[model samples]
Target: MQNRFRANARFGGQRAIVALMLREMSTTYGRSPGGYIWAILSPVAAIAFLSLAFSAFFHTPPIGNSFAMFYATGMVPFLMFNDIQNKVSQSLMYSKQLLAYPKVTFLDALIARFLLNFMTQLLVAYIIFGGTMLFFEGTLSIDILTVLDGLLLAAQLGLGIGTLNCFIYLRFPVWQQMWSVLSRPLFLVSCTMIMFDGIPEPFRDWLWWNPLVHVVGLVREGFYDGYDGYYISSKYVMLVAMVCFALGLLFLRRHHRDLFER
Candidate 1:
């Protein structure tokens, strides 16, 4: 019975995923000099740079008086999405050697990387956001539920986009470079530096098409009681995420063998 249980694909897949996550932790973080500390600090340092660069210009953030708090709200989710997307896109490639084993499926690789990276980002976001509220001189009223929703939506978006890109990267290696270049503009327009309403009318309407704007708005809603972000639509973000994820799963299911061959 014990042996039979291990042979079941569902049971075996879970075990395989856990094992892969453990392997990734050691190889990805455990071997590094700063290890996980860097994960927490990288975003902090980036936020610090943003604060310094912009402080020379604006006396206060468009919405929040504290620039650090404002950017942290936006940057954490954006970074989470970026990190998860990059990590998930490379998941199968990173563990290509291990995929040779029959029990280890590509799904296992995706699941493992998504889980590990999402959890890591969550912890880092919590630490950064919590510390900012505690130490920074600002009034931040946190709605934990809203923050969780924003993070969840960000993770979902990342996983969905990354899953699709994983197959794309496998099929067309040049796409990797192309995507990196394209994503450069995301940081500038992701509402990290400013709020959704802060943008001019036509631009704000156009920017609403980007689901990330909604996620950031939702996050800020939780922080500021007077913040007016009734325009945020969680359903739209979920729909986009679901579509991408469904398409990714469909493509991977159909052409997984071809992906390996390429």
Candidate 2:
């Protein structure tokens, strides 16, 4: 009986997760004129704009095919992380109505938003990858695994930050606004636009501690051999993600009741 009850609980949770994801999807695109087309096109357009802007200044040769490939690998992941973080931060407040339902918890709302963002971002990454290969005739290599690793790392990092943000936003609303303002400069310095290898030695060593830099460098390793020697410790990245995830969960578990009371 206990096992049966546990199974049913798991099934119900999965159902709720799916329902929330669909709800978010409809609200995000269904109401818009172009709907899903905008989600697909937005990233592509950004990649194009960034590629042109960077190429004009840097004059770097194409690593795989065109500048698009280089830019997409870094830009898409970073943008996805940012999008997920923003959405997850706002998820609790946005889904307050849905939370009235007994089965849907605040964490479910976060997971639903993450799922929506993940699916869209994964599609965008593949579209850009396919488009680049088609245009430039670049061969797909084993390094593709690194891209997958980076995606997972980014998701973990986003979840940790998003979960913590949820609690912070509930406890102190001003932090949300402050976080928005502060994240921009941090994004700029995250080595998304430029390769870590391109940075001078002393500065690069100092910046190595930034986990996002490691994430970017790891992704770049799959594309360029030059980045293979870059000093990004994947172990450290994983450790940080684990710590943040644990703390976020603890905070949420302890304060969730208090949050709903407010």
User: Which residue pairs does candidate 2 place in steric collision?
Assistant: none
Q: Residue 206 error for model 1, in Å?
A: 1.6
Candidate 2 worst ten-residue window by lDDT:
58-67
Tens digit per residue, CA lDDT, model 2, 177-211: 89988887766677877777778978888778777
lDDT tens digits by residue: candidate 1, 1-262: 9878756967889999999999999999999999999999999999889888898898987776777888898899999989999999989899999998999998999999999999999999989998888877457677889889989999999998999998888888899999999999998798977777768889988998898888888888888777878889999998988888888888887987787876
lDDT of 1: 0.88
RMSD to the true structure for each prediction, in A, is 2.0, 2.1
> Measured by C-alpha RMSD in angstroms, how accurate is candidate 2?
2.1
Model 2 score (lDDT): 0.77
Give each model a TM-score: 0.95, 0.91
Angstrom error of the Cα, residue 84, model 2: value is: 1.9
| TM-score quality measure for candidate 1 | 0.95
Full-model lDDT for every candidate: 0.88, 0.77
